[model samples]
Target: MPRVVVDVMPKPEILDPQGKAVLGALPRLGFSGVADVRQGKRFELEIEGELTEQVLGEVRQMAETLLSNPVIEDFTVSVETPVAPVPGAGA
Candidate 1:
């Protein structure tokens, strides 16, 4: 199966309170070297069978209509190639 990945994030001009809060906590948690953070969302859709261009177009429409808000956010869609299962390691 091919999977579709949708990533949605706040527009750069928007204020991200959650990201700010996380950024503020990182230093207190002894984590350093991080200047900023922007919160985002990722959605994985497991689609049956091979992925077609029409399916990709539909996914883009889904993202534009439901997954993200165009006014304050932007989104990207990608198709993930199916990963074959490795030979059994468990007895």
Candidate 2:
């Protein structure tokens, strides 16, 4: 099976309150050296068969229409490579 990933983020000019809240909490949580934080969304979609240009195009359309708000958010689509399990790592 093939997989696709979509990443959505607020436009740079837009204010992200959630991101600000996280940034404010980081220092109190004993984490330092982080100057900023921008919250976003990631979606993984599993394909039923071999990945093709049509499927990729459909995924892009999906991202644009349902996954993100084009007015204030930007989204990127990409193919995800599966990570093979390491030999004996679970042992």
Candidate 3:
């Protein structure tokens, strides 16, 4: 199996109130030295069996259409292969 990792972040031009709030609260939360913070989303998807170019295309489309907002955010995708199951482990 293969896994796809999606990382989405709001564009720099957009207003990130959530990130700003977190940054402001970090010092009070004992997280000093943190100069800045940006909010983002990470999604892990387990893709069964082999992954074809078509699947990659679909993944990109899905990311653009549903996973991310094209107006205010940008997203990147990474693919990782899952370790094979041990023989007879679940038997």
lDDT on C-alpha atoms for all candidate structures: 0.92, 0.92, 0.88
After TM-score superposition, the amount by which residue 54's alpha carbon in candidate 1 deviates from its true location, in angstroms, is 0.3
Q: What is the Cα-based TM-score of model 2?
A: 0.89
Number of the top-ranking candidate, with TM-score as the measure = 1
Model 1 ranges off by over 4 Å: 88-91
Q: Candidate 3, residues 12-51: lDDT per residue as tens digits? A: 8998898999999988888888877889899888887678
- Where does candidate 1 clash, by residue pair? none
Give the runs in model 2 whose Cα sits over 4 Å from its true position.
82-91
Q: Give candidate 3 misplaced runs (Cα > 4 Å).
A: 84-91
Backbone clashes for every candidate come to 0, 0, 0
